[model samples]
Target: MLRALCALLGLTSAAIAAKFELSPKKFLTLPLGDIKPAGWLHDQLQVQTDGLAGHMHEFYDLVSKSDWIGGDSYYSYLEEAGSYWFNAMVPNGVLMNNSIINEKTQEFLEYVLENQDATGWLGPEVDTEKPRCLWGRYPFFFGAIQMVEYKPELTARVVDALHKFVKLANRMLRNGEGVDKWAATRWEDFVLTLQWLHDFHPRGEEELLVDTMVRLKWSGVPWEEVFSEEYFPTGPVENLTNPFGLELSWHGVNMAEGFKALPATYRFTHNQSDIDAANLSWDLMFKYHGRPSGAYAADEMLAGLEAVRGTELCLVVEAMFSGSYLYQVIGDLKYADRVERMTYNALPATLTANMWGRQYLQQQNQVAAQNMSPNPFPEDGPYSNVFGLEPNYPCCTVNFPQGWPKFITNAFLVTSDKKGLVQLYLGPFEVQTTLNEDNLVKVSVETFYPFGDNLNITITATKSYMHYIRVPSWIVGGSMTVNDGEKTGLVPDEVTGLLSVTIGKGLTKIALHYPAKIVIEERPHGSIAVHRGPLNYAFDIPRSEKIIAQDPREPHAVDLQMGPIGAWEYALDADPATMSFHNEAENDDHYKLPSPIFDSGKPSVSIAVSACSIEWPLAGDMFVTSPPENPECLGDVKTIQLVPFGATKLRISEFPVFAHSEPSLRVGNSYQIGDDSEPVQKPFNPTKPN
Candidate 1:
């Protein structure tokens, strides 16, 4: 079955064999500036620029005067605050081409690179006897690599400095120097940098790079063993006292970063068990702790499936990055599906619509965004869910910027054979890259995806090539029409879920329609969640936000305490088959998606369903606890609209189902919702020879 799937994905025997011997990446990611955001996506980036992404450095002292840039004080013991800012802002600056941000990024990069110690070690750590934590360098190098990609002149300097660091890292790992703390548990970031250097700019240092990877793997946490069924935690962790011991494995951000370690190491080991364990890691995570918003419960530690449990913003972005990496390495459609799900739903749900202030943690069924006594999170503080600057910690403030920029750059990938282009995730973006070695191709995708069902793609190529469009597993009966000709049904490869189309040179226009339908997902405690396309839907509770605190340096950026101004205790009282979509876009031909599309009252699509007010009680006067197993309607059923999950600041995503009189509606040839179908966890066999 694995061999047959590989063959279906166009993997030749040679390519399959290469998997066991430092194989080529399944997809080659385009550089940072190659893919530019367009349409609403462009607006989204611009808003980020005008918000924290663009101004944080100017006002935030942790970033402006961090030790990495030679400041006297630092934000954390790991010295990663500045590096986190750099990792996020560099991509944002380069993608938006913002002069101010780009200039600032260069200034920071110059200081860090020029001040590298004679020992090849970066940062401000000088105590030689003490064990150095190499975790900070991982994010620092991630940003530095992008800078080199955008500016080729710095390639030599950056490459030389990285080589020196890797040599130092290799020696340190051999001894007992680094990897003593968080670095040991989350060493995938370090290995990822090594792999990048090996694949792109080995410069005769390939052996050293491989050795460094091996040493890192050996010294790092044995994630394969941890993710095994015998050891993997099947429920929320209760022990919070020993956070640095075994409990660190359950840390949300650590789990998000560590899950990808085995998959990444597989590129070198080519061990089939590593691949299986990697797939199982994902399956077990979602099964036990998954949230309806595509995030797993991890406030600071692994919280359970209770709706009130918080998922940190840092975890959300890290999971998206890991998911995208898994897709690129394993070439599985399921990983891509997850990436889309998080990008469309969870990423935006945690932030303020303007992107100025963000929550340290978000709840799946949050009724208010405020501080709580006896907080819901096992390890986070009371203010974790409030919208503020550095509410619980500053990590998210710097780390969240990488989410969208990386997503855009990874949206389109060149196939491993370099003969075709694969549209991995759908969005409004323009990509300019070479396929088949030097065949320059530029493709523009314009769509209100997750809102509108159609993608209008225009391709202009110097040479004809095969274009593989990923048909999202959520999409049913998708079809395509080329050059305004008759529409043809698209039959995607069963395993890969990709529809291949041949594209000729010059201008080619294509219209792909993925008819969106509602899906009812059953959740714990007799609750249910609604979905359409890649988006998760929620009851948008109207809220009144109060400015509780303001940053004097940037007064417009203020912390918010928001509570529901309207009714939020509601239960679904209608059949899924009878629900209808209320799309604002359909009513107007010239509908423009509102700027800051994630804001309330701006949703382009919504679902109107029969619901009744219920007497769901709060856990701690702030947290919306689990709904009643059989919620009784308080009064007559009324129609309420559910907007996209990302658009609501206060929402009920998982709702209790109120038994209705009508039977389940089944339309002709329509997909049914509320089915008991689990996601297929098919492990790819890396040892399979072509």
Candidate 2:
């Protein structure tokens, strides 16, 4: 009977015999807690745990007194805010192994599971006339799915409850019950959860799961049509209400989540157009709205590449999630590159070093983080860019916690065939998983990547296996040595760009050396952004932070108004040959990363460049306008220090080019310190597909 049904659906006989049937993913994601952050990455997670992410439940009304947890204070009728917190906290708690957080997460999970409505609804909206929006369950079930993956004992109960909810959701979606404004446009999230069940725990209910996914896709916004040239916005969206009315395509958060909608749908359809549309969406998004921080400009709506324009923190984290998802499904190197870029640069730029406060919006040329009177954001409020708890909205407050935890989980992925272990993202992590169902592989990565140019990888495997590592596009020339023997130049596959190496039985050590060089990228208005590896370099402006408001229950959780105290109008010299790189961690074995590594002045790497103050003006006395084209140098040239973009709260990232000399240098060529030879200039052809 299953084979007949599979034949009817155009599925293979092998798929019919399998647990569930869906188009195979290019790579398999490890279970939530299979990989753990280590070293500086570990410290990052610990800081997150000690900050707003860990303590939100104690004081925050939306989380502490949420409707889902049997409390009265509900953020919305959809009951999404608390579920956002749950989705983030579950993974963080499990990865950090924090007992307190774990207990809270488990309590919430148990409450929702035990309180399932008799009609099969999962949330608090039991009113049949006004059926609850299915959107909220997207995040809630995401967290529940993670919990089930980590704890097998609860899988049966959770799966049963989810199956019941799925039945109701199928009926509700078919009858046009819960799919509405936000829910209709963002239905891909629900499809993702349904696909998870179909892939992992569909106990003889594959047909129902597939049917639900299809219905949800039909009810959701047509992303392929939305991304087509005829309908997509070529520039910044002006009238947010007109062209894309009712679709909410201009909204920042929706765009971020919707970016992966077609990709998710492709899993069932297996259509090439779906993948092409997703890829096209990515190219167009970054082309028009891309920021130097590896995020797009969408303060509230889809803004342009103007320096003063801000990107929402929620958009930043959501884009990271979408990027990671795209990479897992399509095995695209560009997606992985984007995820790493955002993770290293943009994710930390919006938050306070302690992770207690975060900005709702972050701008590339931000010189101040105070409330703006005439800001550039089209739909956001004046307080959008200020760093605080729930600065502009509470959604970011609950949603931002998922960024680091999910990144850690996605750092290592098993190849589709399960015969190869792939290091998808560079970070300090330890992963223990079974490859090929029997070969147990435990790989430990230790290094300060993007901060330092060395990776110390140790693979302990029960049997010989093939290991693959992604060679970042920014690398000029990297080399690897096995067992500290003769070094070989790292060569990546021409098609996939992955550096493959064979691993033997038992334990083996490998050392990778990638020379870090300064890269100059030309931005709009002839401005330039500096890069070394995945880290974007910016002029870190010293700031004076004033406390404006505080949480009465927790005085430490305060809103801050910050402004630059130092000169931030500097423009870099056009010639890259004169730039210098400094590594303070070099030759200093006693050097230790500060408790909060993203804090200003804590980064061990700095770029010294010859620059001068340019005649730049402020936009509405709030933030700097676009970099002045060929502006006159206001002062004598001086050496200025550039730190990682994540290290600064107020920064000048996109700088004007100060043309003080002749045309002897090019923009794409990289500069390495201590090399006595003249630098070779090369045309900049970015690895991003057009």
Candidate 3:
């Protein structure tokens, strides 16, 4: 039976022209908690689960008891918001390859699945106000796949539910029950879920079901033409006068998810055009609407390249998901690099250090995280930047948790042949998975990562295995040492250009060292943003947070508003060689932190530089805009501190460089520091990808 189904789903010889093999023979995500976080990552997840994300259902009616997915009566029936809340909050206490013991998650899963009707409806009963929605089921479908690793016992049930729903959906489309308006723009995600089902559960009528879903999806949107450059303009369609653009691809969240449709379809058709379409879509987005923090401007639509424009948290998570799948199908490390930048920069900056509150929108060059009118976000409300249980929308409060858990899952993956482990991103993590069912590989990676350049990986396994490591494009002369031996340069692949190696099992030690150099990036309107390795440096604006209690009876209604307590406008020397990299926490033991492991106020690494105060000021803008082009030098250059972008809630990431300043070079000992004694090197002039 399985053989017949697999053959039925296989592509024909004519469709294999440009096909590439995925690293893992199977596309399986680890069960929750399988890839356990270590060092600071572990602390961050604990803070997330212990705070609102873990217990929100108890307080928020959207997840606790709404009509959708058996919740209470805040919404009439299973609405779009509830479905998203379930998808984001489902992975909270799940341990990878293990069972979900939390009574809340367990009960939620049991109630929803057991209530599945014969008609393939898993949500609440259909009513006049809330009829059956294909859009509502789509989120649940994707969420079920994400949770399947931790809840293996529910695999068959999930597949069965999906089969029933797709069958019913096919009938609805044939009988003239058209796709819901809300679901039309998200056809890509629907197709993506169908493709995932076909990949994982290809032992039944998988091919027929997926084809039906794809056809049903395509019947609505002209996705093929929309993704092409001819149909979609490669520039910002959003401006101050008109913020809410109606074009399907112009909407930020839609475009983020939509980029994956062609890539996912390419896995079956093996068509080069599919790959080209995906590339074109991404190129256009970054070329016009890109942000300094690795996100695109979408105050609900395609805002421009300015740093003050806000991006939705939903778009941020969706873009990460799209990038992960794009990497899996295309086998490229660039996708991995994009995910890392967003995870470290945009994802963390929106939430509080304790994870109790979050903002609906975050700006790349934000100087204050406060609620204000006349904000730049054209579509969002005045309270978009307030950190709370739910600011402008409840969607972010539920969607934000998906980032860290999914990042942990994708950190380490098995190769296509199951003979190697691919370390996609750099961070402190420990993973235990089988290489080939008989060969168990256990690895512990320790590093300060974006904070520092040194990485120590220890591997213990039953048999010899191959390993694949990613070397970012920014690294020029990357090298690794085996068991405290000499460093050797790597030979990367011709196509992907990623570093690959073979190793023996049983307690092997490997160390990676690459010098961090300053790379100056030109922003819109001739501003500058500095980068060191994967970390983007930003002015650490001192902030004063004010917590407001909206309702004394509802403690969860409290919101946090922050404002800058110091000046945010500064222009640094134009020469990248003059900036000094300093580690203030170099001597302190990481394990001996007083309480909360990460101290955002005092970042571990910082940039010390001399800068002159500028006349750059805030306007009717969201926060503070970019610094002036050639500001009046207020006084002599004064030394100021710049910290990692993710560590600061309020920051000035994009600044104006002082072009006519005297060169004052200083250096340090990391990455390939420059010719000077201080650890500095000449800038690597990188061109933005087309």
Candidate 4:
């Protein structure tokens, strides 16, 4: 069955592309508990489940009362705002409900029901009352997916409501004779809706699914109106239009790789044209320019290969959702792997480690995280968020929470029994399923991963059925072994880059191979980096040490080599290594910041850091953004040892890799940190002249 998943995807290289049956008692619903924020995900959604619920409610209630909803409403902003609330609140309310928060979510849901239109579309929010399909439709579709899980009967209504909304837009695009220019995008919300409807609808014909795909153009975003661009490139980057502005045309706009929709629509219907369209779209978006972050657009504009400038907060979340869905739609493990990798690194890296904060816009190569501006809104402290999230456009602020809550659902799902294909890793969640006609299986996971590196899955079965545990691509030592039978553990399948674990009935133990130490390596994109295993190791920076990250003062920058190997044995071979460090040099620039933000009047830069002595982990963004001093930086002779980026939140990430002018002559190790002596160098040469 796992092989079939990979082969099924091979049917249409172009088209990429879940849920539950309504029979037995605990069929489609997900399990819940004091779910630890495990995997690379948890940290983002924790705020919604814990602290941010109140503020979110206030924000939702505040928006619900505004002229935000109307027959001719400017819904892009409202939908974005509502989506921000629904994505976090809806799933959290259903899976990890708190009484106080539930009341707010119910109110939001009721408001939508009250405003339903006769056509079955609820989008009275557009100006001129013209119901466009894609943009505003997604947040509502996502909210409905959550609602259906909460209230089963609402499933039909949710489907009908979205069907009405999408059908209306489809009519304008395909059947409407004089509806001006219509919008039908593959990447838009409607495809997400269609994918949902196809997978879970109680009783729906395949024709509707076929119809959705039949009308789309394989061309790029249709650039007939609204979006002003000069070139219609493959990917959606800002200013990627032609000189005269007419080219690969997509859903009436440029950089709109609406191509992702066709194969997705065809996933259920198998329309080759639609599949062809989706593949073409995928080729275009990536061929032009894509980032390692899985986000290509620059500030909602499509700019290709502009390394220093790329990806928005909204794009990161949206792309993750799309990629995960595509993985499910195609039953391809690789797609799931892509989704997992991007979320683990790019998504979290986009926002602050804590969910409460985020950047309005992030530059891919803006290495220094320093803030030069004062707080725009008094209530929001300087370091609380990124630049300029004022009166509106708080997209990242509201939308960021959507990542993890939705991600938990994608973390694991049911696969076929015959094929040993556990397409995902980090599972062992409670999956209430029937093996024979009578027996049930409840799998519980217990392990402190990427940390402790051991797993114990206790599978309690009602009857007898086979379960496959996904084998990760990166196994440090050897493959996993299952107690079920001879070599029950999964071996790697070259066809589908995933390991499998197939076990039969009753309680079973599956041992997955994991390494104790994890080191992150660099990829070609030249943005932020990632580690193969769990530990996201950065250059160690000691908090108590006076060493700071960057020097914004003298245009100082740092760079490094990529794909450098040998981290595994690096620590083991350390010969009683003695290292030195210093106190984090406070930035005077930060002192110039407003109240509660200014520093303690310390210097803008520090000399060096102790490799492992990070005392103040709380001093996040503060230490790294502190600018260094001039070349006379330490006068005659000052030498300090530097640590890893992960070692200190206040330490630097973006550095001037290449030191120009031959280091301007060697400055001695006079500038000391901690209690260390002069530095020592152990050089290795393949052809050493001893």
Candidate 5:
């Protein structure tokens, strides 16, 4: 009788059923207009659309041609690229600031939805003999999933279309048609969409589809084993040890996207080994190919840890997405730390300050942003750094726009229980959400965060609730204050770096103050990377742009070159604690108003330090490479300006340490000097001197 009553009311028997624990999406993303970008954030979004990501269609035949979707074209990937613009770039623009792209976005979305074939394949049906690539399907899927959140009216249509398409894809996979090429290589992307659909619409067979797709993607070797194999990064892509060599983990983009594969599968299997493997894979990647910019080297392949080796723009955005997913699935704060580093440093360094130009590959020690015959990339062309609409490749053109928009979207996240809220990442933004279905909570976060360590949060709530603020792992000895209450030391989670606090009803103001100090990190060679908070410091190399070529039709596809305007070879002469920071906002109130810092195209913060010229040498083509071994100082010590690594177009990030005669300033294995200024507590250990 009890079982019959429970069945009648639609309650499941917890014993027999899987309990449907809210899939991968227990927390919801705010609508496009809910957490709008403010200050510099708004300006950057506008510039993005006004520039290449928005205007590529005007000049490129792939984006503008009607045949891209309906007619047979050799370059089928362009069709997916078009879908990216419609699915993400356009909607993101309007959502960001109600830009002029709204009307066109509406028109494009309506056309795609209304014109869907009865068979449910939304893309063009052409060239059945062609390899039936499955990877191209995912970009559209990502766009459609995002649409389900942005436009609620389109949900039913999108869901039906995705369901029918997944069934068709599953059929193709069973017949051995779509299991061959790029689809097989980057199966993680396809698998993630399956997981998403199953969780969103759990209408019985969705689970079967997800499981089938996961199996197809897994082939014979489990993803955990694939990630755990230790033979990586020894040679070229052909030398990989796994079966189906040169297919999956060797590619940088695949490696990044693969970071989430094990975690995604863990959802269904509940395997602890998957989690452990995911952590191990990250360590291996960093150990082999990590760059100072918090990304792995992949100049179209697994490049090694030379500071000059470049990372693709596609990898930057994909890695951030992977990090975001890992944080959501694993609830790890270290993932957030990685995301912050990549978003602030690697993502912006590839684009021009105005967002009008971008590079296909960005190098950490880049001295000249121009094409060279013998480029550092194994497969990239000479025009990699020309910073046109698409320099060496156009994949970045279609994919890169998603980086900032999604980063902003993920700025504020709710707790798994939906009772508390957490700031997953920080920038200039506001978050408004309801807690417990009755108490409304709104938070306004204002600060030039990475540029400044102080953050002021104003909370207006209808009732009391718990708020979790993430303290970055880099921060030490920070303090938090609430409504003029006792200033409390931030007791951060040693592992996750989160600080939790409770708030009462009405409006309350909280201030977070963390001291910003520079710490030197020893790099691969005998060089050091200077860091403060989350920003990496680089020598302030001046740059002048030279236009190489331009498309007569489109204004955005102009090949431009950047050459350094100042000398870049300098060694650290004084301690990091003596490094001084200067920004005009310190005196100007108008500039201090909270906004994202880069949109203005003017980096406000500058680090001043005493440095002496060094005898560093350059590689072929005059490009700066690894700093030379501890060489004699060439010039008298001079005070030079260093800017944030992300702010400069051409810079030398790592520098050799200078030897000094001072006794108290001795480091781990070598001697150095410090000016009269106090020294930071945990300075980098000096590398062993030759």
Candidate 6:
């Protein structure tokens, strides 16, 4: 393959002399478009906006005007909710650009600017006037740094405030001041803020700020003391923890928050001290925090060392956003890899399938919640989990926006030589770097990712620049061709490889090979699971809604294939039609039955899918699943297609051992499942003792 200059998307060398400018933001022209994953974020934003419509303006007014203690708790709730929307939106959301929801952000900005003191502090209810003022600027900076299209002046204001706060805080700390005797821990926040100031200001006041932050020394707080782990983070929490005893002090995701801010410490000032401090903390965090979902743990109470506790909604959103930030600054595929896993498995697992809502917390085993709230809320908000506004806590209520759609920022970033680089592999369209240098390069990349084999990169070359594309570390025997002339084959490895293309000089035609791959990794103790791309599929289960009428034999175990995706094709083994449905009596412990207490201790088996929808008349449809035949003993059920654990609405991810190995039932080719030959059965009783 020789070097040849080809036309860039139909543009010739003569007209390709567009001036390229450097962007202070990650990718220069990111003003227009929505976030990534596209499944939940788009709908959630639209619905969340609608949900806030009735109280949106009022909510902003409440935050701006409410006095801390003189008013009712509603004001505090309003402040909390406003804080959530403010946090979730700016970095990424419907208001990142010129949208209706942006008005709320403007209102917040107005409030901040109007309330600034002569000393440059802007916070409410301050007793000692600590550096708490810095917390308010995150919203502004998050927006100004990302959206190059809107609010440039606002961005400058954000930068100005950042410097002001850092300088003021340095003086305060020097004079021995800043939030005396606080219940919650908020140490690295100062580290992060100083880092941000360092990064934002080109003139290099970051050194002094970083030094000041390092001296603050609030890093050693124990895990249990914090008032809210959701806001005032403490301790090391990870998914890879052993669930045995009263291990209250271990949490990986909680620790990962600190790790997340580590690299940011370095990127701000390019200094080794800040970087080293961050790395030492991050290295320890990753050791305890890494999880099976490709994320570090922190579901709820820190289940340390192994995934004792499950993941929480707040951790999921935060972990994903943190991973995205990690990807952008460090350029590590592993971070992006973790982000994709959390996005697909842990993330979707947190929310309901219809996008109406998500859970406050999620457990891997998720034993039947002796008393779970089915319709937790009155259905006021789209994903509103609480009775109306606030749920288990304000964490997920405000943090949900960061989970799905905000992934767009993590999709693409610029390389050292002014080229485009793809971070995570899950995708649909080809993403261009839009920047020739720092400014808009006026380019669009065209390709369908994650769906099929080929990916095309068509760049409208403004000038000859270096373009680097990530060849996914997961792709097996992947091959790529440039301009349909030169072709190169790639070897699969644990890490990604860069494929470089020079624009205008033979960058016209493009094709990249995505090998269909299956990943098999051994679990900690025993057993192995398989993954295809980002999806980890398990054995196909047969379902039936008819069984809801009958009783379930057992609840602890479930029937699934020996492996993740069934290796052999057996059609008749599982039937969705045999599932049943029944209303359990209030306080009725055992699987609710129409008749008297059963001799056997078991649950009535209804299709898991039906378990989610039957609770609501909102689901209007007749063909839920087909009915079972004489299923009194086997548990009567109506049948329908049952998605694997990963796909089901109310699913069990980690099932017990007995169900995995079905001695009587085995999959075979040409055998149709859900037919009369093979009966599909599962235990659903939530240990309701008669």
The per-model lDDT (C-alpha) reads 0.80, 0.81, 0.68, 0.41, 0.68, 0.40
Task: For candidate 6, give the lDDT of residue 272.
Answer: 48
**Which one wins on TM-score?**
2
Provide the TM-score for each candidate, comma-separated: 0.92, 0.93, 0.88, 0.63, 0.89, 0.62
For 1-690, candidate 3 gives per-residue lDDT tens digits of: 222322454544455322222222233355565688887677777777777777666667666654444433334224555566556656656632213325655665666677778887776564345446576666666667766766688888788777777778777766656366556667667777766666677556654654564455454555566666565655556443322233555678887877777776676556667787777677667767776677778887777777887888888988988887777767665667777778877888777777778888888788777778676677778788888888887777767777887787777776666677888778889988877758888889988777667779998889888887877655546679988678897666644545776677678898987656666667765577777777777887888888864535357557988888888788876666667887644555553222233346545777776688878877764357656776777777887877778777888888886664433432221123345544222232223431
> Count of backbone clashes for each model?
1, 0, 27, 75, 0, 73
lDDT of 4 by residue, 1-690 (tens): 222332433433222232211111101223223122332223234444553333544443324445345444333333456655665667666545466666766776667766777765564444554544445446766776777766786766667766676666565545532121223233344555665665567255344443453333321133222222233354442334444343323221223324334445455435455434443444445445444333454444554544334355666666666656554544444445545544554555554332333454443333333332443212223332232222124555566666666666655555533222232546324344443465555666654332234566666665455555544444434445567445333355543445544456566776665532122222222222223332222332222311123223221111111111111000110111222222232222223212111111211211231121111111233222211211112122223333322122222232211112221112131111111342221111101100
- lDDT for each residue of candidate 1 in 454-491, tens digit (9 for 90 to 100): 89999999999999898887765667999968999877
Q: What tens digits encode model 5's per-residue C-alpha lDDT throughout 464-485?
A: 8888788875665668999989
Q: If candidate 6 were superposed on the true structure by all CA atoms, what would the RMSD be?
A: 15.8
Candidate 2 residue lDDT tens string, 1-690: 434544554545553335445787888888888899998999999999999999988988778844444433345423678789999999999999999999999988887887788989876644334546788778888899899889989899898998999999888876788887888778898888888888778778888887787677677677777777777776677653435455476778888999879788778767677789898888878877787678888878778778788888888888898988888888777788777888989999999999999999998899999888776577788888889988978899999999999999888888988999989889789999998959999989988887888899999999999999988766666789999689998778654558999999998999998775676766789887887778889998889999999999887689999998888888888666778788898768777777688988899999899999888888785578889988888889899999999999999999998784543344332333334453322222232421
User: Who is ahead in lDDT, 2 or 5?
Assistant: 2
TM-score of 1: 0.92
What does the lDDT read for residue 516 in candidate 1?
55
TM-score of 6: 0.62
- Give me the displacement of residue 136 in model 3, in angstroms: 2.0
- Clashing residue pairs in candidate 5, if any? none
